[model samples]
Target: MYLYDHYDQAMVDARVAEFRDQTRRRIEGTLSEEKFRPLRLQNGLYLQLHAYMLRVAVPYGTLSGAQMKMLGDIADKYDRGYGHFTTRQNIQYNWIKLEDTPDILADLASVEMHAIQTSGNCIRNISADQYAGATADELIDPRPYAELLRQWSSFHPEFLALPRKFKICVIASDTDRAAMRLHDIGIQIVKNEAGEIGAAFYVGGGMGRTPFIAPLVKAFVPLDELITYSEACLRVYNRYGRRDNKYKARIKILVHELGVDEYRRQVEEEFAHLQTLAIEPPLAELERIKTFFADPAYEAGLSDDLDLSNPAFAAWVKNNTAAHKTPGYAIVNISLKPVKTLADGSKQAGIPGDATGEQIRVMADLAKTYSFDELRVTHTQNIVLPHVRKADLFTVWEKLVAAELAEANLDKITDIIACPGLDYCTLANARSIPVAQKIAERMADKAEEIGELKLKISGCINACGHHHAGHIGILGVDRKGLENYQLLLGGCEGADTSLGKIVGPGFDEDGIVGAVEKATQVYLANKEGEERFLDTYRRIGMNPFKEAIYG
Candidate 1:
């Protein structure tokens, strides 16, 4: 993890002081809500349906154990005793007091975290692969570049008030775990045929009322021009992007209105102009950032074997762990989604991505004890102990099991990615959490059979839950003044990114859950050997699943 320098500390400290005064003024009635709206939003405070919500940034989803512990402390001290981890690789507290926000910011500042850019129509938190440095498949660790972009975009005067909020993702792997193509700006660091490293720019990807998989704007941009090219893309969007309508203000909308070729041409022209400005950070600075991400010390000649004698531990190891780039080590994922059976024998779903303060503290302790004192928040609303020794797998699993955090359902139907829908978000049309819970319970028994299914839910079209990218996506809508859920299929967020298509007419809450189960049953019955739910859906198409569900 990168430690904050003096300049970084100074800026955060200054923002805290500034916001303290702003918040005081709002509370004292010296500042009107209309006036304080943007100011509070700039600092990541939102007035939700019931109470104020505070979103704290976890840059690229990386946090030190101490930071994670502080997050737990914040949850305990300020709001309710739980925090909601979001799809943007950030965390949110649903019940925040207006007067206590400054103190919360101060607490976060001490840990080198803040709420800045977590909201508003500005560049939001930069996201990346959760297993960036430790994963076996990446070409290079992309966090350094992500950090550089973070520093560059933080309060950049030019982008502070864009036509709409912009999101950027950096991934070095070809597997696309970060949903690279579904961002406003997706930069994939790649090696060319000449064996030189560069970036492939995919601009104009987003999901909302309108969903778009950004087209490849530039196939290869030299490493030296990464920041400049990114700025060029933003400049183009800012210059011509629509300001009249909030609905069509995102860069994705601009790219849709203008063809990819023209957008690329404009970006190229801007890139040429930015080259003279020398806006890209110097190579020395990137090298300095890279130093923070170097591999942890590993004992040489360690064995890469796990004892699978215990059936429970074997299941956890099989589902929640991934191969590490270093031998004898593994990437461990802690599932936040825990399913509980009520005394009535009905299933009760633990709220997805909502980790209680005690659970967060437990995870922090585990990270410190096992994973080099580091933890990562995945885009799927899970946490990752990026580098855990294989020898300690069982102990870690045991600890997680004791904490009730070991769910052994990674990518399974039960491992759902859903937003805090009508429950917390005022913009939501229907309840998303209940729908997610129902689906999880309905499919829990068959989740192992329906393997590698990415199910996502959003209360509205904002796509905060990333429903557009799920293998089976669910969207809640307001239909005839009632909460209706729509089922979508064939969505995938990996390397072959594709938006889900709605199967047919919307259904009521129970109907939607049954519809999802029917779709899965179709997959199980028709699937070839070893085929995932997504593979089966693609091979068999929507007709079979649609007939089963609607008929």
Candidate 2:
């Protein structure tokens, strides 16, 4: 995690003071709702369906235990006693009072956090893999680059009023856990044959009314020119991206209208122009940011006495754990899947309820006690304690079970990813959570037969849940006020990623789980015993799954 420099600290302090005054005016009626909308949105405050929602940035999805505690405190004192972890790897409080927002920002500032650039048509939070620095396969830590972009884009005068909201993702690993290809700007960190590290840039990728897998703009952008080149890309979009219609305002629309080749040519021309006035950050400054992300002090010795035989611990290890960069530690995913009965009983059908305050507190404590006091909210709607020592795995699993947070399904079939659909989001066309929950429960019932799979659901084409990247994707839609879902399959999130294709006609929300189950059964029947769902799907292609799903 990068600490704020004096410049960063000063800017945040000043912004807090400015927002405090803005708050006072809004409450005093000196500023009308119409007038205050943009001001409040710039600070990450939104007037939602029922109340104001305050989204706080968890930069690159990294948080210290103390920071997590502060978030828990904010949830306890300011709003309801729980926060919603979002797909963008941020946290949201849905019941904030308008007057309390500035105070909340001040509180967040105390912990080196804030709500800046979280909303409105500006560069939003820069997301990276939750397992960034700790992942065993990373080419390099991507956080320093993410942090640099954060500083450069935050309140960048030219970009604050872009044609539409823009998102950027940077991934250092060959495996695309961050869904880099789906971002407005996806940068893959890679080393050239000459052994110099640079970025492979992908542009115009997004998932809204229109979905696209961004095409590559540069095979290798020099490390020193990342900022300049990014600025050039945004500047081109800001200048030419559609603004006449909200539906076509995104850069993706621009890319679609102009065609990818033309879009690339435009960006290249812009890049060439930016080179004349390039304002590269000093190499020393880049190195300084990198220092903050240097590997944590890790013990070198291995403990052979560790036991992994307990059934519950074994299940958790087998399902929710991943290899760490260090030999003696593991990345642990805390499942958000409710018990089958509770999941079925929830009002919205498939979505689980927010983590209770007690659950949040337990997780915070566990992070402090067992995982170096660090926690990451994953894109899969689960929390990750990324650096748990191998020795503490069983103890952590036991504590998680007591809190009902341990379902022992990390990348398994029941570990579904879904967004807060109709339950909370006004933009949702149908309820997504319920659909995801039902599918998870269905898979759980056939846990032995289903084996490993990924099912992702999103309420609409916005693809907040990343439905496009799932091996099994479910997208919710509205048909004459009736909830319906479309099923897609064969998408992947790893090295050789591709978007899923729709299986056939859509299903009513109630029929979605059965449809998914049918598809899974086809995979099970057709697969070689040891093959994963994705491997099986690729080997057999989508026809088998589609025929089975729609049969």
Choose the strongest candidate by lDDT: 1
Mark the regions of model 1 whose C-alpha exceeds 4 Å error after superposition.
342-345
List lDDT for all candidates, in order.
0.92, 0.83
TM-score of 2: 0.94
Error of 2 at 30 (Å): 3.6
Give lDDT for model 2: 0.83
| Candidate 1 similarity to native, TM-score | 0.99
Total clashing pairs for each candidate: 0, 4
Q: Give the least accurate 10-residue stretch of model 1, judged by summed lDDT.
A: 340-349
Against the true structure, whose TM-score is highest? 1
lDDT of 1 by residue, 1-551 (tens): 99999999999999999999999899899999999988899888999999999999999999999999999999999988999998989999999999999999999999999999888889999999999999889999999989999999988899888999899999999999999899999999999999998889999999898999989999898877888988999989988999999999999888888889888888889888999998888889989999999998876788997789999899999999999988899999999888876798877788999998999999999999999999999989999999899999999999999989999999999999999999999899999999999888888878887889999999999988889999999999999899999999999999999999999999999999999999989998998999999998889899999899977
